[model samples]
Target: MYEIIFNLHSFLAYIVLAILGIALINAILGLTGKKDFTLEKDFRISLFALILSHLQLLVGLVLYFVSARGFSAIQEFGMGGLTSAARLLAVEHPFINILALVFITIGWSKHKNLMEASRKFKTIAIFYGIGLLLILSRLPWSQWF
Candidate 1:
């Protein structure tokens, strides 16, 4: 069960990151060009990115609870006792990812409330770009790739 969830989470991370990147790029282009926020493409891309990210967050939360390198590591080694690698997995990754999701969610909500196309694009670009950076920063690169 743990392995399945772990693999799923890993696989989904790639998809989520790709979609998020596309969405961010699209948003930036729309903002810079002052393009109309079309429902067909613009809305769909942002919505897809938002949904995928939320799903990834859910799977990650489950993995955190079940994986030995996650909460178990923190339990086994007290906060201060954990090595840098251990701390990254047991603390930094999960916490920062959660915060990243919050930013994405906020961006989605804020974009919806606004009537201006430029503002909507700007909000998504800024928020999702930050979230993407946060996720990239805390990824366990040694273990993952």
Candidate 2:
């Protein structure tokens, strides 16, 4: 169970990263080019990125609960006793990812309510950019490589 979930979470991370990156780049282009926010391209990519990110978060939550490298390590060793690597997996990664998701969600919501294309592009650029940075900052880069 743990292995299946762990693998799923890892696989999902790659997809999430790629889509989110593309979304961010799309947003940046829309803003710079002063392009109208099209449902076909701009909106679809952002929504896809948002949905995929939510899925990744759900899978990660399950992995966190079940994996020894996640919450179990915290429970077994306590917070202070965990090595930096253990703390990175058990604490930092989950917390940062959740916060990133919140930013992404806010971006999605705000984009929907905005009347102007510029505002929509700007909203996604700022919020999704922040979310992407946050996720990148705490990822277990060593493990991924």
Give the per-residue lDDT of model 1 (tens digit) for 75-126. 8978998899989989999999999999999999999999999999999999
What TM-score do all the candidates reach, one by one? 0.97, 0.98
Task: Give the Å error, residue 29, model 2.
Answer: 0.4
What TM-score does structure 1 among the candidates reach?
Answer: 0.97
Deviating ranges (above 4 Å) for candidate 1: none
Residue pairs in candidate 2 whose N, alpha carbon or C atoms collide under 3 angstroms: none
**Superposition TM-score, candidate 2 onto the true structure:** 0.98
Off by over 4 Å in 2: none
Error of 2 at 120 (Å): 0.2
Tell me how candidate 2 scores on lDDT.
0.96
What do the candidate models score in CA lDDT, each in turn? 0.95, 0.96
The superposed Cα distance between candidate 2 and the true structure at residue 58, in angstroms, equals 0.3
